[model samples]
Target: MARTARGFAALALAVALFGSSGCGYNTLVSEREAVESAWGEVQNQLQRRNDLVPNLVETVRGFAAQEENVLREVTEARSRVGGAATPSEAIEASNQLSNALSRLLVVVERYPELRSNQNFLRLQDELAGTENRLGVARKRYNDAVQRYNTTARRFPTNLVARVFGFEARDYFEAPESARGVPQVDFQRRP
Candidate 1:
């Protein structure tokens, strides 16, 4: 009777431990995966934007070879973005690229002929679409990061996260310069 009672006590302890751990463990795993997947999507959209830059640059070059400084700035920014090692670095580099592209667009407005070119128009359309996609992906990544960080910081799940070495992720925040709406006056002369 004593031996049977001891066995039952041990089994109950094991069951309680397993039951408590299972939910927390699974939540951490899934949240981490969500962050990873979202980051991948952000990278994908950035890559698509990167791929389109050169073609767009070449098209602009044919029309406005004199805008060397603007073109060079865009090219250099693109290179920085491509060479970035981490997410923060990539975000900073991408912001630089965005600024350069904005400058290039302003320069494009100065050349009416370039704006009318079929190739330039097509590339511009594709680039605009890519930028839109990048925005969506960045938002998704930030949302995922928020979710993961929340899970990692929460009481019960945080215990599991700590045991498993899961850390909170940084968010993809917009730069200060990006906070303001860009003044794009298409009707006004550049």
Candidate 2:
């Protein structure tokens, strides 16, 4: 009777330790994967936007050839976006691209012909849709990062996270320049 009781107690202790650790580890892994998958979606949307920008730029250029500075800025921003390798880097690059594009779009308003052209109008609509999709993807990525960070920082899992080196991830956030509406100045040309 005494031997049987001791064996049961030992088994129970092992099960308890394993159960807690296993749950914590598995949850961390699942949440990290969710964040990764979300990041992939963000990258895809960014690529789509990058692909669409040249067409828009070209269309605008045909009508407003003198807006060379604005066009060059957009081209530079798009290039930076393609070069970004990490999430934080990507966020910064994407925000710059957004700002540059916003400026380009604002400039477009100055050219009634560009705005009214069928090709330009269609490209503008597509770019607008792509921006909306990109916004959603960024939201999803941030949500996933929140979940993973929350899980990694929580009790029990925090210990597991440390043990496994599952660090927190950066959320996709817009910079100040990208957050507000682009300022429009009807009085000047730069």
Candidate 3:
């Protein structure tokens, strides 16, 4: 009878251990998935912005072909963003694209007719909306990363994360140059 009782106790201990580990493992998996979903959203928004670029460029080009430097910069920046292999690289390339787009907008301002063009106006509005979406996605992604990183670094769960090779993700940070309020001069030339 004592031997049978000892066997049952061993079984209960084993079950408890397995159940505890399973819970922690599942939580880690859930948090990791949240981070991935957020990252996917950020990428989706970025892609949407990228898809709108060509239309924007074409519309502006029809009205401001002489703005070759700005156009080339925007094109090259877009290419970099498209080919980026990592989050950090993507962020850097995104900043370059943003700066190029800003320059393109400034050039458009110089040509008042471009601003009045129907297609240009439409594309500009679409791009602005896409940019807003990207901002929201980026915020969501950062929030997810913060949660995952914090939980992954905490006690007990960190052990499971380490065992499962779940590493923390990098946050999308805007470049220092792009962090300031954009300057816009509204004075018309005489």
Candidate 4:
């Protein structure tokens, strides 16, 4: 009878251990979901920016026919953003595009006539709003990544994360070239 009781106790302990591990798995899954949702927001904001680019380019082109350099830069940046494969790469490309667009807008400022144009102003306002949204999305994504990474690295959750192959996510950092406001040369020949 003592031997049978000892076997039952061992079985109970095993079940308790399994139950504890299951809780850890649940926490890991929840944290990963949070990260994924945040990433989705980031992607949405990027798509918004991409969608706004063509309209912005056309508006700029309508008033500033001689601004070939600015147009080309914006086009190149847009192409880079479209070709980006990873989240990190997309952020970098987006930053590049933002810088290029900023330079182009500064050029537009020189043409007071262009600035007064209703269509150009509307596109500029929309782009500005999209930039703000993108910034918020990136911050949210970073916060979620931090939470997931912290949970995944914690003692009990670490074991489950390892088992489930959860890896650390990269932060959305602006590109080095876009560290500051891009210099805009608006020197048109007199």
lDDT of 4 by residue, 101-185 (tens): 8878777877877777888778878888988998999899999889989988987677778878988888888777667766554
RMSD of each: 4.1, 4.4, 4.4, 4.4
Q: Candidate 1, which segments miss by more than 4 Å at Cα?
A: 1-21
Winner by TM-score between candidate 4 and candidate 3 = 3
Give the range where candidate 1 is weakest over 10 consecutive residues by summed lDDT: 181-190
lDDT of all predictions:
0.88, 0.89, 0.84, 0.83
Expressed as tens digits, the lDDT of each residue in 1-190 for candidate 3 is 9999999999997677656666777887888899889888888887888898988888888888888888989988999989998888888888899999988877877877777788887888898899999999999999998988887887666777788898988998888878898875534431
Count clashing residue pairs per candidate: 0, 0, 0, 0
**Worst ten-residue run, lDDT, model 3?**
181-190
Q: Which tens-of-lDDT digit does each residue in 29-145 have in candidate 2?
A: 999999999999999999999999999899989989999999999999999999998888889999999989988978987976666699987887898899899999999999999
> What lDDT, from 0 to 1, does candidate 3 have?
0.84
Collision pairs in model 1: none
CA error at residue 166 for candidate 2, angstroms: 0.3
Q: Which window of ten consecutive residues has the lowest lDDT sum in model 2?
A: 181-190
Q: How many backbone clashes does candidate 2 have?
A: 0
Give the TM-scores of the predictions, in the order they appear. Answer: 0.86, 0.87, 0.84, 0.81
Residue 18 displacement in candidate 1 (angstroms): 7.9
